[model samples]
Target: MTDTLNAKNHSIEKYLRQDRMPHIWCSGCGIGPAVSCFLRAIDRAEIDPNKIALVSGIGCTGRVAGYVKLDSFHTTHGRAIPFATGLKLAKPELKAVVFSGDGDLVAIGGNHLIHAARRNIDMTVICVNNFNYGMTGGQVGPTSPLEARTTTTPYGNFEPPFNLPYLASASGASYVARWTVLHLRELERAITEAMIKPGFSFIDVIAPCPPIYGRMNKMPLPMDSMHYYQEKTIIRHGADPKEADITLNGPILAGTFVDIERPTFQDQLNHISSKVNAQV
Candidate 1:
């Protein structure tokens, strides 16, 4: 490979689709920062952008597929995982990274998410958790905290939100981490780790949707939501996963919660194949 081919470019603009410059996401939306972090992570990993496959679903964050200049797929809503799963299984050489919103993944695609984790599929899932469904007029979602207000939850939400990292860890994901936009460096590092890890890796990014979810609440600007994350996020390193909880109104438990080595889905499949072939 030529030196230019592997050169580390800090500016993600070079890798972005210029025609999609003016993204559909609202101003002050956390999606932009999340995309930047993801790009930075790819750069940090020293992986060829050509070798990466970005898969996304229908949501504000899903616009990432249209923005990045890699092998990208803009699939149906809540089905990015199944698409990514097939891509990874077919071309196991490709690095599959899925980017989706909380509503697209944990809600409508909840079964896929858990099953993917349980299978320990070799891929990385980056979920931009803005709490409410930002693309759909700020409706209540599975990631919306208890008592949070949304378009559908005018009287405050009565349901509980899923602690995504915990759910992933419990579902057999080999690696799980949660980071907010405030921790940009940490978020990048977590993403890079997830990408290189040889098993099912899930990163739930606590993003802020200023125009929709934020506006409905007191945070009217994207920076306001970012500052809120700065103030409400308690940085606890090496924290116990069992003690972590997603906070809707208070300080949130944020950190790289889980990292364990398990037999990857591919590895287990190969083992089974060898055993079956021996019997034949």
Candidate 2:
């Protein structure tokens, strides 16, 4: 408890394990910013880090579980949500957060994502979509845009990428937001909001993997990636899901895409309990 208190009073750097000084991520990977933003979000929430449980799936982003000095679980690939769902149900007071990758969540774990949203599970999911399977040596992922080159897509990717924010919103996520690593402040705020939200909250962080993924797509440098996001990104408030497709290239079109009050899983269960207890 004292340690958590100290972490709150002092900088998040105090909470980080200096012994784990050099992370395993590549030189220009955006995972570093993602982690930093998450820590900032945690600080902004003013919630005890001890009470937060981080659940992650197998991927580059999944490695976050080991880095954060909290109750963390590095679960199987694409199973972070189900594991988190169980954890939230067992301990409703704890803040359950899922950290996964584009391939980990949208590809293999697509079903889990939607089901969790449908249940309105009280958990926050922050997925880092670098547009390729970076951990696996830059393979084509579900979020990889058309014409993007990958290991598998040597010529050019033909299939359309899933508009993650729109998908999440339509799938019933109570809170949905999208932001690139370049927009660190907004990303931090979105993460904080998602963590505090009572229902399923999903954030698609468009990060850049300069080494493996970006190198293949001609975005080999971190600065180039950042500049790309800066020029292409359009930060808006209260964006409509319907307009997302029409303005894909015009602006990154990121903001609180969807936020609506819904009966959380715990709320429904408690309501049923109250009714039964009344009758008894």
Candidate 3:
């Protein structure tokens, strides 16, 4: 236990800006674990820290860019993808990683998400889904499960949530996966795989919003949310994305749903350019 703690502390000091020592995430919030898993994944993947560029939009998870010790951008609300897209295209050698909350990425930035996947850009997106707009208030969001309660959905959420993995796969993502904060090993593995994958890779990390979303939904303690995730999760690697919809109290379908090789947008562009030059 002591050695593990020491290792994590070392990783935090190495990967994050020490001046930002205390993060602003709430108690029992799962973003911390997600970040830890991410840090470990970067090392395990053998990626050079100097070659990574993390981009995030405005939200709770968006603060990651400001904290990580890497070339990062904290862009305008819902613009993380567009910003990352520009950065990736400009510096194709750098590993572009987009880290943000579901609200920032899928709600207002949904268009960018689909189009980026359609282009099969060489980028990795790590979306922390807490099922509500966590930063402002506990409001229902694009990924709030059906019947999930929140400040806005007092009675219960009527709208169905997007099956994130399914959406990414359908939008042409070259790699897709989902995992809760409770599954640290799996989460880290998925992030590592996504980081090394060549095309548009995405991972939906289901984290707890204990103070707001969880308390409102009856998971009062952070542990309560963690336990819920552990008990409800169903791992089915390579499962069909269409059958992975998440409901308020139903099983949480989690795993890698898609991973297929395809020429990236940059690769295609370079190919065409070479042909044009040859003909000219």
Error in Å for residue 170 of model 2: 0.7
* lDDT ranking from best candidate downward: 3, 1, 2
RMSD, every candidate, angstroms: 4.3, 4.2, 1.9
lDDT of 1 at 58: 89
Residue 134 C-alpha lDDT in model 2: 86
**Model 3, 271: alpha-carbon shift in Å?**
1.3
Q: How does each model score on lDDT?
A: 0.87, 0.86, 0.93
> On residues 109-227, what C-alpha lDDT tens digit does candidate 2 reach at each position?
99999989988999999999888888888888888888888899999888888888888888889999988898899899999989888899999888888898778878889887888
Ranked by TM-score from best down, the candidates are: 3, 1, 2
Give one digit per residue, the lDDT tens place, for model 1 in 1-280. 5553322544787778777767887877777888999998888999989899999998888889999899999999899999999999999999999999999999999999999999999999999999988877999999888878889998888997787878899999988888888888999999999999999999888888887877777788778877878888887766776666775668878888788999988999999999999999
TM-scores of the models, in the order given: 0.94, 0.92, 0.96
Worst 10 residues of 1 by lDDT: 1-10
In TM-score terms, candidate 3 sits at 0.96
